[model samples]
Target chain A: MGLQRGVCVIGAGMTRFHHKIHKDKSGRELFVEAALEAMESVDKGIERKDIQALFVGYFTPSLYEHQGHIGPLVTDWMGLTPITGWRTETACASSIAAFMTGVLAIASGWYDVVMVGGVEKMTALPTEGVTDALSVAADDDYEIPAGATFPGLYALLAQAYFKKYNMTWEDLQAIPIKNHHNGALNPKAQFQEEIMDIAKRIGQREGVTFKDPLDFLKSKYNRVIAWPLRLFDCCPISDGAAVAILAAEDVAKKFTDTPIRVAGIGFGTDTLALHDRISLTSFASAVFASRQAYKMAGIEPKDVDVVEVHDCFSIAEVIATEDLGLFERGEGLKAAVEGRTALDGDRPVNPSGGLKCKGHPVGATGAAMIHELWKQLRGEAGKRQIPDAEIGLAHNVGGTGASCGVVILRR
Target chain B: MVSGSAAQFLTKTFYDKLKEGKLIGCRCKKCNFVMIPPRLLCKECGSKDLELVEFKGTGTLETFTVIHVPPMRLKNVAPYVTGIVKLDEGPMIMGRIVGVDPNKPEELRMGQRMQMEVIEEDGKPVLAFKPVS
Candidate 1:
């Protein structure tokens, strides 16, 4: 919601997302991998010295990785020392928060070329420990003390959406099904196989006959971590990193003739506690952020050809589509059920799978979404490309919709 | 019967009564905001001039979730329903839902009337809600 200076992504990169405990690869190692890949993605090789500043996004590395001062550490590891660097954190939206800061800084004419990266090194802790670390993003005194986990919090939203819209569990299943279908096409996706494969494996292991995928999804194993949400609905705890190079629009042509311009950017925040929110079905932050982005881009929901929304939970994508104004209130699940958000539908969403399938590495997820959008808009997303995608949008949310960032790109 | 932790510190006399199927909230003298979970201080006015008030365990279901997977402590109780109930006394409380089918999303409607039932969990009386027909 400021001056409309143009910014373009010159390169993008990411490390393979996985559980890396014994390898001793820290968050900095992951960031280096992604930064190298991004440098390689550029047509003309970029020197480490060319990066004027570095922006890093991370969450709970102090707890999980036992490392802090991630900004300078990543910069030093990437051999971009002497360049100014800082870390931005907003729980899961850390990477996007960094990306947004880089954009704003460039727009303000503070810097010409900048590198943005997000990294999260979870999986070093046990499942319960991870849950406890993530719960810190909530209202610690009120929500966490009452035994509210992220899954339980989102489950409340899912239940409210279902109750208000007359939707069934089947409607929610459509999200995982669609995301997994797309994830299978992505080489870097965490869960690259279809859900039916999981079902078959479980059936064989348990010596029980699973009638179909639907039955498998509804099985006790997939049952809710918090009621109305099952294991399948949640994004996996992952360790990954992503990087993108942003340059002022005037010099963008020097990198790539076909550059995707940062058409719009918006961000908003809400109360940390769910109890203070007026509606459970929609996030006020996302609505406000998307509006800001749309207004800045001089576009509307109708102008968006493709979207990559935060599907940290399967239900999140449903609420995001509605909150982004892609569909009217209480109609997001219906749109999803009707396949309107499918790859070949009117408005393709999450073509690179999503956080649900592509894996959510907290800080990395926001930058990863932008990386996917960059590839799609440049017509480089093989097998998962939306046809003639002139405009694309990315929505990233942090901690049960407490913080949200929306970015729009135009080719 | 209260848990060892609750028994270790009998800070509020009403907490002892809550274990006997009594619903109690704290009313602040300044703002008159009733806290269902019974806060030590008023959230609105930050007043410690609080008094305990018994609440009728009746309300409406504002929202709810059918938890298919539970935490390790509640693993045996998978497929349980939990919800935020807006009590008649003007306080929202999060608790488990009893006497309902978790799989039946159709049955869990918002604004549906609910009545509270106190169940023993870890030797402590835990309050829950049940849909009223």
Candidate 2:
């Protein structure tokens, strides 16, 4: 069902997503830091007490921070206590769910202004611990017990998609290369170096020369994490936070004259386990959510000018693009390899560098995507800005596409 | 969601039969819809009338992956091949592909006939698959 009144995003902010950067900062600290930045970004400033309620999305505070009940903790940290707050968890898409909740809160005439965001502090644990933490999002009894790690699970999809479409792994190289390029321009991205630059730097440091990007990717340093997904193809563990401020459309002018309207919002979920899905080649959750958002917004995929997708892996970007109806089935791979998704391309995808470069802080990823869309829609993206960008879409997915959220924004 | 045997499906009996090298799944008597590892109710039609029927122990390899980095439980066998198979009885199930080089995943062809067998690992029976010659 559609909302009674529209919700518009007036301000958005995020901390630099990195692995070791936010070492001493706790999840709540990161949340407050991002929240303060978002508050300051509004065209016309608003006070903290003006925010009616808080909705925080944190995937696993127990695993990372050894803390639970993070909703109250975040509100307390922001000094907005007793204003009503709740936490959302959907593996990686946690923050998007929070954003959707905040939008509905405004649309229902329940609250005129709401603050929503997510935070993930994953560097507290070892790499193996993070992998295990992410894997539990799948069906515990079925997938996890059978030695199914996230990469291995996605590897199965990559294999099946490759076999069905007669594709090779070489086609995937384009995605990382492109993301790295856009990330190079993003000041806040975790990895801001181009793939070729990284290759050259690593070659010099290791005293091993490389001919090109592909050659460097094949080396032992970039060794395989899974069968087809190399280390370069996977997103790194990062700690960061992102927040967005939403206000009712009629009352939005008080906060910001340039409010980007949340034109459409949609959410969908499917069976957690991988085997239960009818088709592994595409994410049904993404398709269902995107279709609902497109229908509600009265716009097709082609109407979207710039987009950001949940590219947890290179293959995931392909699947998300096709599932969102941005590209045809089996055509996403070719689109990636042909640079059809480049920053300056026809349908620019992930101009914010996506999860591969902008960094995936689990809970904060969704709000970070919205932050990028807010920038690009306002003609604020300095180097990666799409010319004449009017509308943008953000697609965030939880573990293995089990949960999905698609939001369409218009400037 | 698959809480326990109290649901009448997704119970220990599914794995118990596998120890004897028997493949069984839930088959809907009314709709003739079959599912691997059994289920309390049919997902297609919500048919509660179901029976455990022995499968032919054969299927086609739908997809597979070689896990270089396994979970904490399977750390010993770090690099192993696990796959999804579309059974002859019309259900997709997860099984580790045995009798093949895990590193050379390309050798595992899709749509190739695979024989299902129950293999004991750490004193627990798990469903596995091998290329049928």
Candidate 3:
């Protein structure tokens, strides 16, 4: 909305998301790896000189890696020297913001070609340290003072949603099961095994067994992180990177044979603290952003044959689908149970296993969602690909929806 | 005290007041819109003519959650209950829900009358609520 020039993603790439796989690697290293892959992905070939700007998203490098000025740092690491660059931050949606910023840069005719990506080396921090770092996304004063943990915040949303819709905890488990199933197909996903496989493997190790995935999930082994939200319900702390190359629409084909058009992109915001929201059950920011994006794209939610949503927690996926108008408020809770969001389902959501399975490296998440959509549109997505997907959407929420960004891509 | 902007200082004043058994809100002189965790300027009308006003400290529980795994600073006090309370003064605020079984969340219901109180944590006053049964 900020710029008039049309833009499209020419290439996209990412590293395998994980908790410890990138232990020997830094955020910059992961970023370069994804960037190099993206460079190699352009069908017509691309060089470092072709990229005129750099937009990166990293949640907290100063805290995660004791590093700052990550924009030029990563630019230099990628061998794209002397180009103007800046880092974007909006909690987990940082990378989506970067991608939108890149769109603006290209659309403004300020730059012909630009690189947008997100990286977060979150595994370096201990659990609580990670929690503390992420909390900065929420209201620092009221939320932290009230002991509102990230999980606790979403848990509160889950409770409110359940109360409003009369849904049970069992109805929500379908999300992880479906996401894990999709994740099992993704080579780059953090958790590549189904809940059944994980249950068996971990059970064998702990000398405990279960009747099924649901039984295993119900067990204390998947103990509550927050009431009504168990361990499996929360996304893991991961270290990874995702990058997308964007070019003006006219020049897009020069780089890639099948450029995914940036159809509609919009950003929205709400009060930082969950308490400040008018309703706990929905994020008005997400709804506003999605509506703006739809109007820009000139396509309804029905046109989105596939989508990748910010599922930092399970309840989020439901809220997002509802907020984005993909499903009615109460219907989103049952979408998973009804198998409507499956990869083979009519409207596949998060075919890349979403943030829950693909891994949520905060800053990398938004870009990764776009990466999945790109693959789906190009028919590059192998197992999790939705059939004949023409348009797709990525919804990224910052904190408990304090900041939100939506991007719709069309093939 | 967490050090930051003057706006944050004004917010910290809200906590300082809580420690002294007071519930304060910043009321705009123009529109009379109140910001509970006080603000430097009125969000509604952008009026700088704002003053702290005392609230009845009584409200209804809007929603709640029992934190099973808290952050590092709160790890010692794991399994604390947090909730959003709609203040009778017309703003919602977040605080710990004390004097209730955090595990038995069923015991708490939405719209239940709640009263604000302060509990000491790390020598700082933390805001909390208790159901008025």
Candidate 4:
């Protein structure tokens, strides 16, 4: 069935994702910055009062920022209080969940124009504390209690992938290197400089010489956090915000003539514990969500012109590509090493640098992914633009692939 | 001195059995799905008919990861391999890989035959898997 009413993304915005102390600013402040930027992106801007609803996504705000009731807090800061505002939490895919809700609300004829935003201020906690907080999204009874952190969990996936595909640690480095290369061109990316640059600087500082990027990657400083997965392979603990303005297709043109239509949307959830999954190489949530989204869009994986898949860790991108049906099972790593996912490659994946380099702000990651696709589909992506891009897709996944949201956008 | 939280209860049971060289799983009555960590409910049918069944201590390596930087409790045993093994009784279990080098990939192939054995860690019988000889 078609969306009862059409929903189109008219504007998008994001705050540079970074690690911020609570003393600097709160998560609400970061959301406001992104929301304001989104408002400015609209060609024919409407008054903030005209916004009918707001969807906000945040993870561990109560623990990280010591803030609760974030829904009203963000609306109050945006001066949209008294308007309907709700908080959506699904770990890293929280914002995408909120975005999907906003889309459904418009399609259901409940709200004509809605402002969807996601924010996370998690860097306020120390590294150990943050890891503990994020672990709550996983199956606490099985995973966390077994001394499984996020990295450890993903490292398991990495190990499985390596075993199944006969890959090496050096192959994994290709992901971070590519993402960093793209991130260097992105002004909003957290790790803007390539890791090789960092490696060179460290070598110079220590009066030593690195054989190559892989050599530096293997060193103790960049030592493995999980076996076969190094510190560089994991996404950083980040703080940031992102927002998008969605409107019914009838009213979307009023805001902008070049609105990106929400062609399809799908979401799915799977077993919280990794042990319950039948296969570690593919996320069932992503596979199911992609199937639903593709069916609704009346397209296949081959139709997507550009893509933004969750690369929370390097191995995740490999898994996501296979789960999304972009490549054959157990072949995503080979694609990455072969330069098939590069911006200039035939299929450009994560031109936004992905979470690997773009920075994952948990709550904001999903919406931020959509924001990148919107820009790419509209030919607005400055340096990392995909050539001849028309149809774009974004896949946002939550803790350990428990939840996933996939959306297709077409210009 | 054992914490009696619900999360720890099953692991405690497993630990108690580990001391006796037994690996246990919960077999579901509704779907016959066996949970390796011994869950309270069946994942496939959502049934709570769980019977603790001891595995045959033999399985195949489904996948694995070599951890270079272990957590605080595992730091002393850094550079160890952890993997999911598909047991003969039809369930996947995650545990450390013993009796193998962590750095070599040629030794850890998918679907490689393996067998489980109990090892002492901190004076507790912890279960680990080794490549079949």
Candidate 5:
């Protein structure tokens, strides 16, 4: 079955995802900033009174900001009070769920227009506090009791992949390097400098020299957070928000002459712990969710021109490409190593530099992906634009492989 | 037949058995699927008809990683090895790997036989595994 009444994205906007830049801003302010940008993005301009409702995806507000009841809180902040508003949570995929909820509400003929977005004020806490807060998404009784951190959970997947494919840790470095190159071109990204540039700058200050990015990565500067997964291999914590405006398909043109149609929406969940799954080489939730989305969209993996998958870690991107059927199993890493997943590659992935360099504000990541896709499809993604991008997809996952959401959009 | 209903297959029960020098799991009476850290329902067939079962404390190392940065509670035990072991009883579980050098991960081999051992961390009983030469 398909959407009863179609929904289209008329406008989207996001703040530059970074750690230090948004240090003083709270989640409410970050969301309002993104919402204002989204309002400005509307071609014909829409008013707050015209919007029917609101749906937000903000994970760990209580832990990060020591606040709850953020749905009405953000609604009031945006001056859209008295309109029904609420929040959704699925760990990192929270906003995708919110976006899908907005889609369903419109498709069900309940509302003609709605605003969907995600926000996270992660920098409010220290690194360790953030880590503890995020780990709550996992199986607390099982996974966390075994001393598994986020990096360590992914490290296990990398280890299994290396053993099955006979690859090495050095093979995964291409991901961070390529993402950094893409991030350099994205003003909204957290780390805007290339890996080699950062390496050289650090080397000059530390009284050390390196031959290249790989050499610098192998040095002590990139200390191992988990064996086979170093500092650069992990995404840094950042604070940001993303907002998108959705309109019923028939009335989409009232706000914009050109609107991106929501082609497909799919979400799936698996066991929380990795040990309970059939295999560690791939995320079954992503596979299941993407398959459903492709079927509903009536398209094949080859039809996707550009994509933004969750790259919370380098190896995660590798597994995501495979799970989405963009690359064959055990071939994702090789694709990255060969520049096939670069901005100018045959199968371009994460044109926003991914969560790796774009920065992972956790809750904001899912909608931020949609923000990138909207820019790409509209020929508005300035430097990292994929030429003539027609069909775009976004894959978002929660803790480990427990939850996933796959969304497809077309111009 | 193992005593107690599916209610006995709780988290505290599993850890208590480990503290008593016994490694226990649960088997679905309907599907015969075994799972570690005992659960009330079977993941394979959605059957609550489960019974407690004892393991021989042996398995094969499936995958592993050395955690150089651990959670706050595990801060004192940084740079420790954690892995998933495919137990002989047909279910896999995650635990710490001891009796080996955490820094030298290249020395470890997949498919190597392992023996389960109970260890204390943060004043709580935690499962651990050691390589069986």
Candidate 6:
């Protein structure tokens, strides 16, 4: 069944995703910063009392900050108490769940206006600590004991994909190259420099020159984290937050004339461990979730004007494009190489630079994807904007495809 | 050997059998579905009535990766090979792929036959696989 009542996002906001910039800020402070920006983004303006309730998604507060019970704490911090608030989590897809929860609340007609957002204070912990914390999202008793890291898990998928498609690691380089190019245009992106520029800088410091981005990528400086997956292939550990203010259709215009409607939202799950999945090249969760979303939206993949998919690893973007039906299976890598998924390409994926260049603050990533789509749909995405973009989609995955959520939005 | 009553498809029980040089899995009586690192219920049909079965400990290498940046727990064993094995009985599981140079992952090929090996890590049995000529 479709939503009982129409729901739309009137405003969205996000802090620049980075590791060091937000170091002095706590998760609560970062969340409030984003929420204030969201409220300010409303053309008609809004107040704290206008929000009826709140939903927050934070993946690992306990391990990262020795904290829990974030929902009420953030509500209390925002001074919007007693309005009913809680936390929702599905690992990296946490904030999308929060966004969906807010949509459901508005659709239920229980609350006309509510706040949905996510926050992650990942920089508090060291890299190894972050790795150990994120591993909890996998099956601790099984996958973790088998020595599976997140990148290693995706690398296995890359291996299977390469063997199945007659592709090589060289074929996947187009993804980071394109994303970094897009990231160079997005001021909020953590790495706002093109790969070649970065290569030139590093080359000068090391007294070496590179012919192209590929040469720099293949160099020892790009050192392997997992076979076929290098440092540039992964998203960095980051700290930030993103927020979206949602209003029911009737009252949405009171907030903004160009409200982005929540046309379709879908979520799905598969076996937690990678070995249990029927296919390694594609995520069953992405297929199921995107299918549900497309059915609800009554639109095909071609109708989507732009997209923001979870590219936690470079290989993931290629797989996500196919799973979401943007490209045929085994054709995703080729599409990336041909620039079909570039900013100016027919199918633009991750114009906001995705998690790779955008910096993935896990819990905040899903809502942050929404933040990018909100800008694109409203014609506010500057420089990296997709012209005449009316319909946009966001795909977020959690824990090696154990959980996934897809949201489709339109102007 | 552990008592039959104590074999309830628990992780401890699965590893205990691995400690004894045996790889035991479970098959659901209702759906005839088998799983390694066995579960209390069948994933296919959700049946609680299950029977323990031993695997031949052999399968094909479906896919593999060499982890260069190891997690803190496995730091001393950096650059270890891990892969999924499609067991003969139809269930697939993850384990270390040994008997090959981790530094030379190019030597590995998909669909190669492999045999299971139980190796000890921190005094506890851990599952692994090795290529068979």
Predicted complexes: DockQ each: 0.28, 0.62, 0.78, 0.37, 0.85, 0.81
Tell me the native contact fraction for each prediction: 0.39, 0.53, 0.87, 0.44, 0.81, 0.75
Candidate 5: tens digits of C-alpha lDDT, residues A47-130: 999788899998899999999998999999999899989999999999998899999999999999999999999989887888
Candidate with maximal DockQ: 5
If both were scored by TM-score, which would come out higher, candidate 1 or candidate 4?
Answer: 4
Q: What's the lDDT of the predicted structure labeled candidate 4? A: 0.85
TM-score of chain A of each: 0.97, 0.99, 0.98, 0.98, 0.99, 0.99
Q: Which digits, one per residue and each the tens of the lDDT, describe model 2 over residues A121-150?
A: 999988888888888788775676567788
* Worst 10 contiguous positions by lDDT, candidate 5 chain A: A138-147
- C-alpha displacement of A170 in model 5, angstroms? 0.9
Screening candidate 1 with a backbone cut-off below 3 angstroms (N, C-alpha, C), the clashing residue pairs are A223-B68, A223-B69, A224-B68, A224-B69, A226-B67, A227-B66, A227-B67, A228-B66
Candidate that beats the other on DockQ, 2 or 6, i.e. the better one? 6
Candidate 3 CAPRI level: medium
lDDT per residue as tens, model 3, B1-133: 2323445427668877888988877777789897787788887898887777788889999888888888888888888889999999899999999989877878888889999888988898888999997
Model 5 segments more than 4 A misplaced: none
Model 2 per-residue lDDT at A229: 81
By summed lDDT, which 10 consecutive residues of candidate 2 chain A come out lowest? A139-148
Error of 6 at A244 (Å): 0.4
Model 4 chain A, TM-score vs. native: 0.98
Q: Give the TM-score of chain A in candidate 2.
A: 0.99
lDDT of 6 at A384: 95
For candidate 3 chain A, the 10 contiguous residues with the lowest summed lDDT are A1-10
Give the higher-DockQ candidate: 2 or 3.
Answer: 3
Better of 1 and 2 by TM-score: 2
- TM values, all candidates: 0.85, 0.96, 0.96, 0.89, 0.98, 0.98
lDDT for each residue of candidate 4 in A1-411, tens digit (9 for 90 to 100): 558888999999999887643238788899999999999999898789879999999978888977889899988999998999989999989999999989988999999999997998877887767777787888754454345667878988887777678897799888898898889888888888888898989999988778888889989779767766788899988888999999999998889889999999999999887877878888999999999999989999999999999998899999999999999997888999999998888778899889988899899999999889888988888999887788999999999899999999999
Q: Relative to the unseen true structure, what is the Cα RMSD of model 1? A: 5.3
lDDT of 5 at B117: 90
By descending DockQ, how would the candidates be arranged?
5, 6, 3, 2, 4, 1
Q: After aligning candidate 5 to the native by TM-score, how far in Å is the CA of B100 from where it should be? A: 1.3
